[model samples]
Target chain A: MADAVIAAIPPGRHARLIVPRLLQRGEDFTARLLIQHPMETGFRRDDTGKVLPANVIENVVLLFNDELVFRGRVLNALSANPSLSVQLTAQKSGTLSAHWRDQMGNVGSISTEVRVAGA
Target chain B: MPKHAQRRTLLGAVAAAPWWWAAFVGTASAQSSTAGSDALDERVRAAVLVRGGLSLDIPVIVETGTSVPIVLFADPSQLRPGVRVTRLGIIAPKNPRPVALDMELGALMSQARIATNIRLGASQSVTGVALLSDGTVWQQSIAVVLTGSACYDGT
Candidate 1:
């Protein structure tokens, strides 16, 4: 079931991350992450009445400078094209990255530079 | 019996029924909905939950349950020195799987907050549970009414 879902996704961008280009040290800011996927609940049926296998993202992890910041488990109950926003503090300049895996075992990751001034 | 006395008796009966109160009264009364999920129950049982240190932000009424946005925020003042929130969970009582989202936080997080969208199968109460590093759990619940369902298979 997982293999079929992975095959359905088109080749291209699978995720996007939005972070401020610049930040002040010791300041808190919101980082938004959006993933492109159907997030199928497996409870829905196709036009011909076939049950859609659950193909939602299973886990998400956010990291800063190689340090884990936030991790989450995604379930079928989340809406399709899932978007997550988390609050993070700027302690120093580093790299902010996000990685996620779907129930189908497909992995997607994206990273951005976090520039903090006066660190 | 007199007409006024009969009316009073009917009102009293409605107020006296436990189920009626659970259905109408909001907040704590709607906790019974959490019973549908064993994961939620086990977490609640394992922690020391204090009602109201967290706040849930979601509309009281929504036209569709397809993508209802919600935000969970924990009071920073409630945390003692050297203690921080380490985990968070979101539970929708009426969904096929009541446990919607589970998250773990690390030290880099300046605030105990998160925003996301979720699917709701019906108009029901949603609960947010946060676990702190000091073994304290803060919980908050909000009721949401959906005019249309989101998870119906047949559509």
Candidate 2:
């Protein structure tokens, strides 16, 4: 329920999953994930000279057809609008979904379908 | 010899052996246990302190305020069977917070290669660490010299 609530909150930035709409069975594919966030390191101060609290995506999880596939833990070192490229082998066509949670408990997710071509 | 006599002879031989031999075995086991703990300590330090690993795929030379690209790779076939590479992390030791990026590798993923962009606050080495499900950690670090610095005030 907490995750659902977090997911339901309006996303503060644009997040996109870039994948081919279709793929050939057994084809090796690369998927790119893009999420727009400041990746605040808490080291910077505001215009008023107050240190900003650190806020960053603590972890990210990716699932293919409800099976855990990829997971990542990120730190403040990532530049603004962090993106990741990952390789996958397409054994079967299915939905690839990604979920990420920030230090502040904000959650964001995106999904795309990959149609596997018949031999 | 009778079976009972043979058992008594074996016991007598063990009791007659020098105490130093027993000490040697004890010492060997103790040394092994220490080595295991030392390895675990190293892993904890690497994961937490961003200390060491394999090799980083970034230019040795760089400039400030630019998006630096980095890649980490490992042969999937070399990984232990049924063990998935679950986590990848990047850190710049000199930064305010050294950690840059960390991601999870999806299931049935073979290649352990990852690429991403990062910003440098100063000239420093960026460390990348890969974590496998089998508790194995692989790391690599590359040093990059930045000509300037990126100024930022949290807006």
- Residue B149, candidate 2: alpha-carbon lDDT: 53
Q: What is the TM-score of each candidate against the true structure?
A: 0.79, 0.69
Q: What share of the true interface contacts does candidate 2 keep?
A: 0.74
Q: What TM-scores result for chain A when each predicted structure is judged separately against the true chain A? A: 0.85, 0.83
> What docking grade applies to model 1?
acceptable
- Highest-scoring model, lDDT: 1
Q: What DockQ does predicted model 2 obtain?
A: 0.37
Name the regions of candidate 2 deviating beyond 4 angstroms. Answer: A1-12, B1-55, B77-84, B133-136, B150-155
Candidate 1's C-alpha runs over 4 A off are A1-13, B1-46
Model 2 CA RMSD to the hidden true structure, in angstroms: 13.8
Each candidate: RMSD: 8.4, 13.8
Q: Which candidate is the best by TM-score?
A: 1
